[model samples]
Target: MYDHRKLGRELNLFDTDPLIGAGLPYWLPDGALIRHILEEYIRSVERQAGYRHVYSPVLGKRELYEISGHWSHYSDDMFPPMDLGNEQVVLRPSLCPHHAVMYRSRSHSYRELPLRMAELGGMYRSELSGVLGGLTRVRAIHLNDAHIFCTLDQVADEAQAALEMIRRAYEALGITPTRYRLSLPGPGGKYVADAEKWQRSTALLTDVLERFGLAFEAAEGEAAFYGPKIDVQVTDGAGRESTLSTIQVDFHQPEQFDLHYIGADGAKHRPVMVHRSIIGSVERAVAHLIEQHGGAFPAWLAPTQLAILPISDAELPNAAALARRCAELGLRAEIISAERGSLGARIREVRQVPYQAVIGAKEAADHYVSLRLRDGRRLDPQPDGDVLARIRAFVDAHGTALWDNAARHCPERKS
Candidate 1:
């Protein structure tokens, strides 16, 4: 029964002002901080897994989509053309074509067969206004987008490695959903123009999944226009299911884009293409996070990790100094000026922030801070560094701003 709109408003995450067109989100400072944390999380995971960060254009020439078959299958979702001097440009619907352009920038040898490129690419899509819902569905969104180019022989290991990274991501986000799906696009629906290639690619993916012991359901016609995909789905709190991650197999795109790699055989070979988003789209994931956690974020992901409340104006400076120390240790902290309201009212406000540090004149004078845990465990007065260390340890263990006292608070599951 957690209303996302109300929570979003109260938390200052984002809003849809009537003045701004619908489905276009304007993230407030708090929301932007969360976005940075998410992006950094993905980037850190990707880099450790050998992905090179890349930047691709927000729009591309019409020829790019025409080559990739998006112009025919998904043109309606694209923003209308922009006349760029002599060329007609359309906003990129996906990151594959641009990634292909990156591949073609240089001739890669067999040693570089599995070149992984990742981007936090912002994209624009003209969605029907009626279908938009907060961050879950939006016209403009950014993706945790990535593309992998691997030799046909190397596809399985590459795919499995991608899955490992995704698993780490799920753990980091504190999501544990028992049911997972590997969606193979329904053939003959969108991008399977070559029957022989489709059959081989699909079979190759199936074998890869079997060899990896990964279970999946074949989704006939669900494949992207350029390839077949394995979609990762998680059921939300209300028994509604949605995609959380995806790994797509593409053979046609290499041929369509004339991509090539020098193989061990010393000849040109078309490397298989894998498009993956471990966390899917950020907007969609954050929306799902709100739903999954019922708006109670874990410590690591909480926008405001530690809210400080001083008993009176005399203690504000001390609380502010402690908050600064918290920030230096990579924790987000804010101090409520004591004059804003009564100490009890302040504590109520502190609960809304998930974690709070209460400062009284005695505690401030003693150079110790009182911690009010989310689950009602209050530590009387402790050293500032010790309190900060405990908070960091809790956040580190939970990966997000989640309370570690699970015996007290029941953490949500995706289903």
Candidate 2:
């Protein structure tokens, strides 16, 4: 069994320090690179899909959450409030209330039917020490969060678009969900007590899923206090099922915030709010990828994409030049110098770079390199420029099959 904790240490992705408190994981350079790539890739996708990214405060006045009802509903799960004597505030557990205030900041007309705001926002939630796991279960979180405030008539269309985004992400990343839970309002008092609003919200979501032909089972009482939701449950390497993605419809927040926009009839009307996360917590997604791929990331997602291995000190100059070229082309490359370790010693199997090029006098002289993939496959000797082009094409395609994508196209796997 491949444990993410062990692999995370081996890869130097992140570590938990006791002084920093439990669930606070620190990122290393290599790990930060991977996180950077993930955010860049996902942010690009969001921008293309008509989302406007915003940076908001992670700390908020206690009154802000109180107005949005989180203070009453989830005050225990939230960090204790800080009293400035004049006023009190606490770390935000979610970005929902802040976004509601943002929407309230602007008075809009019917033309702005659907206003979408997005962010890779940082949030905090208080968790017991015993329950805190790796990055997957943490107090500090960066969420792939977005909110769509739209007209009532726009609900289905907006919901469909959100689900489509989730589908595209999961497909490109090779993630498979074990099941979908239609988390409707439960019998418990945890949910908002507006029976009519609950019925309407649940119906709208049910209709959207049916239209998309999605399969899901209804789980009573699994919804958020404010809304009905679609929870994607993925079975991890350890066979533990957890929800890492969600599409939720909230009628409570907008009503509570008294959010309104002008309607076609020139009258003010409340907008229905849709809250979603294609990838819930960014840290958990990274942790999931670590475990799912066993730290053998896809070439596109790999931090140090290529390793320059010079067989002897004689080829050091050539290796350095190759690494420079890769860096200039926006590719991450590392030159494994002989000063630190042997070529064989540096290639520590799975933890090594996804691609390695062994350079010697002859190959350096020829100005061509034969690439060796992590799967032990050798790409035919090609000019440095040509190899870079091929790697860029794979990255542009969001290649998810890892080294296999290269091996299948190559002549053979090298020992």
Please provide TM-scores, in order, for all candidate models, with all chains considered together: 0.91, 0.94
What would the per-residue lDDT of candidate 2 be over residues 60-125, giving only the tens digit for each residue? Answer: 999999988898878889999999879998999999999999999989887987999999999999
Give the per-residue lDDT digits (tens) of candidate 1, residues 221-301: 667776666777876555767777888788877888899989889999888898889998888887777766776677788
> Which candidate leads in TM-score?
2
* Top candidate when judged by lDDT against the true structure: 2
Model 2 alpha-carbon miss at residue 258, Å:
0.7
True lDDT of residue 116, candidate 1: 91
The total number of steric clashes, by the backbone 3 Å criterion, in model 2 comes to 1
Show the lowest summed lDDT stretch of 10 residues, model 1. 406-415
